[model samples]
Target chain A: MNLIVAILSGAVVYAVSVLYAGIGETFTERSGVMNLGVEGIMLMGAMSGCVTAFHTRNLALAMLIVILTGAVLGLIFAFLTVTLQSDQTVCGMAMLILGTGLSGFLGEDIASKPINLKFTKIPLPVLSEIPIIGDILFNQNLLVYIMYLLLPLATFYIYKTRWGLKLRALGENPAVLDAAGENVFAMRYGYIVFGTTMMAISGAFVSLAQTNVWQEGMTAGKGWIAFALVAFSSWNPATLALGALLFGFISNLGSNLQIYLPGVPTEIFSAMPYVATIVVLIISTGNFRKKHTAEPAALAKAYDRESR
Target chain B: MSAMNKFRFEKREKQSALRTLIITAVSVLLALVCCGILIFSVGSKPLKVYETMLTQVFLSPTGIKNMLRSSLPLMFCGLGVALTFKMNLNNIGAEGQYAAGVIAGGAFVLFGPDIEGVPGMIITALCCFLGGAIWALICAIPKAYWGVNESITTLMMNYIALMILAYLCLGPWKMPRQNTGMTERIPRSMDIPEIMIGDIQISVGVFIGIIVAALIYCAYKYTTGGYQLTVISKSPKSAQYAGISIKKNILMVMSLSGGLAGLAGFMQYAGVAHRIVENMPNNAGYTAIVIAYLSRLNPFTVVVVSILFGGLQNSTAYVQSLGVPSQIATMMQGVIMIFVIAGDFFQRYRLVIAKEGKA
Candidate 1:
């Protein structure tokens, strides 16, 4: 593979992992529930996938385990923040800790060890042969292919449909949605679960598709980056997709550059993605020059039926 | 809804002090029970593990010293986090800020002039504080000025700070003739002294933590600046209406928070390790968040909770020999936090089952 194509292809592979979680968080924040436990949840999903693969050696079972783990966690989180009406930020932090702690405890035995299972790349027919573009985007795992459809489908789902409209309204004003005979609590619960399950898929991608190994807290700060990207892209799925790819390319560019410059400490390049997230977060949200943000008004606020 | 079982939660107008204490105590007890189950699941008898942990963490002289010794970083980090949290600024980057403090403090000890004893220690401490404050301000300025989410930005900065620390430890500052990832030890003149009380040794740094906590307590209870923080936390719009400078306070509180977290590095360096090392704070920064929240942002309570929580964190080392994973400490913190959050909700509201048909 040519160097440029390789980087682009690598970028796609990298972008898919975070994009799944990013888009998931987009849906979550859009529904007025901001989950800060993305890192923890991602770790748990990754751990569950690794454990299942090691024990069962069935990729299907591993994937199912990941989803089940995410569903259970997502339900607990929704119960705490939505039904219990706890502080979303604090609860989110607790969830993050809970996920990280649980995963770390459970996955301790597998640290630095191989799971002996991987999602092998399957290039699509004809599409994988289209000069440069095909190889860059088409030659990837099944999960990467799903992203191609997910991006547009999610954008259309949130913007073009009544359910999407209601989701947006739920974030902006749950009281208004409640007045319109909508099940505000149930809708929030549904989105929260869906978002968390998507985060699990993101984690499974890392363990089962990308690395094929289990490392404690191996998702690192990608979950945090996804959380920030929610605000960075101004809550637009299309823009968020582009931003994630840009991250993919820039982050890959660092490793590519390392081949030419060997004297600089490797940690600097490692820090690039995180530093970039901070910079991008500032650029997109910093209202510099009076740019408007499409933020959901009732975000992170608990809604009570009697209050309205 | 069935009339016989119909119930609703009603918020209390005021939560009494006794209720607050009861809620906290019950939550902690519940968390311990959950952790006991966790230990049992790992194949060890929960009773034996708890007995070992309780004795090792609190009973022995060395255990008492270690508990207070390990609590040093938590004291500073918890105080730091407690302050920013009071103003609703989620400065989760204290872990990174603590690293920045170590890096800066190390740089000074390696290159700066040698001054022995107390003044030198004070200067080094100040340097560490400045390092942490500067690291925190990176997120604070953007948050205060541009509405950037402080929580995410602070978190992202943790990786950045760790990278810089790793860069130094591996590249320029790597100790000569040693494979370990750390800088050289500080001069003996700069080391914080430990006084022996019978079989135990307590570093003066712990006193410094207590003093700092007391100072923060006074500021929070009596100062106009602290009053402004409460106003902003309650409602930014109302704070603005009342002419409180939210931006200035955000910058101030976050810097202080970061600086205090940075002081944790100083504790590890001068008081404990006497050398700058990688993973220095060891997640005391995150544990501090749980401590701060559980302590209810009270400085005096923060001191007490830091020791208890720090004991929980450090005591895992004792149980690792008994088939319990060291990560149990981290899990315990999470469990306790969840319980506390749930317990707080109960304290604020009560479910009243109403019999509408009978009435």
Candidate 2:
């Protein structure tokens, strides 16, 4: 039962983190831009959040700092890829290196230092009584509940709102939005900042909730999984949540199996998340091929309004 | 001056070549400044550190040899990456392929007889090359057939390779009766022989790397295959209309690229490290990617760039001797890569004020 509790705790945190990343990526992709810098953006957030938390020992303030730092990194990426019309791949790759270097260098002294936040956990008195489901859902950190709330909010924001429509329109055909007299760059920038901020929060969640101390390269390949989940869910927020949960489950399974199945090669088990990501990417791409649907027409293209 | 001449002032046409050169120069300058700041922050004189780094890499004979030795794997990995980039394929799996090559080469060393003379070395080299190419082909084939994103595939493969390497080090391949998680020393018979010139000992691996670079340069400069790849990269649609098979080309180039990286692993075992160890390439795979891009994916230029970076890597220990953390060097590499990439914006586009009615 305690093992189950441990597994559940890990899964909840993992799901929330991945959800933040996936939702953020969906926003960027909707603006007809692919920010491969999710990993980098996450690093920035993790560092900013961890450093703040380490010194102040305040979890809430640390979260705020991480979100703000994410916004700045996102804006920089947006300015480069959207405003400057640079290659998205190169920009993303550059940002990845920059983020990793910055975080590792800045966070070097405090990487393993313990600074517990004593994060608040929420539980329903009656709901917590239910056996399996109660432990899984009713008893989790406030962030987990917040993630659950944001899942629907994100879905509504993308599917129902006028701004969401405009964002999607850019992905499909920026010329249409341009013809409609919308400032495509500004619109894309808005989404990029929003998305980048979300990614940072996701990174911060790991440090603030799951563990108190920050480690170098701690995000591992979670950023990539978030990127992959965007496609796995076919860019739908609801589906994205499901995809993230599934990924979290796989991750949980890998770690859980580490103790139960001691005879198994832990190395192979350690590779589960990345392998699952590759499998998801391949499978999702295969589905796309089967459906014969094209990605957003303007995806990965930098629009130069003056070129014509 | 006539009124017509006065009004007909010619606008300067953007010189693409000049733009590229200027951006590269600016990026390099920025990188140096960043390194300078980092060194200064560490309470050391940046100039002194750089001098030590340079003198150790270029001025001393032993230093030059070490630089060349360190450069061997980088040369192969850089060239491999360059070849893939030339074809517009992102093969980020060189690190994985190198790991696989080590596994294959190590197996031969541990399992096969310590055959004497050049035959042993030749067989080992062939095995390593084939090992890398075969390992690389796994990803290439899936990417070609399934439309799988090679970037993710290659990146994931790196983890898988790392795990496999870990398993080998810790499991059945673990050194017999040894506490350390390393294979037994490879017999000297299976190793590449060191050459002596006067008082200097030159490893044959460096010679092989230089020869490979020369060969790659020739291929890129003169061969039809190279021209085909160049054409494909510039405009894939045109190549297809011209009857070139994109799938076949992708597979072929990726395999060749992987094979080159594998050869690095082979040489490392045969000439340099002489045994399979943990993190053998260290960050060489990633560093090679940066070097390949800095050289604009030109095979010949890649050779020059590799040496420059290899020198930096060789001088890292020397830089540490200056009381600065050697990790600063890695940070410098990352910073340089960022500036190099961001510098592309200035090369491809120029800022201009909006003309009348353009907005």
The candidate that wins on DockQ is 1
Question: What is the TM-score, restricted to chain A, for candidate 2?
Answer: 0.94
How well is each residue in B189-288 modelled by candidate 1, as lDDT tens digits?
7788889988888878888888999998888779998788888988999999999999999999999999998899889889888888766878888888
- Clash list (residue pairs), candidate 1: none
RMSD score of candidate 1 (Å): 1.5
Candidate 1 lDDT by residue in tens digits, A242-289: 888888888898888888898876777888999899898888888776
Off by over 4 Å in 1: B197-199
> DockQ (C-alpha) of model 1?
0.79
**lDDT string, candidate 2, A1-308, tens digits:** 87777677677778888889889988889888998878877877888898998888777888889989888888878878886677787677667766776677667657788867636577878987898778888788887888888989888987899977888899988887898899998988988899899999888877777677778768877887888788778788898888887878788888997987888888877888888888887888754458664467788888876553
Give the worst 10-residue stretch by lDDT in candidate 2 chain A.
Answer: A286-295
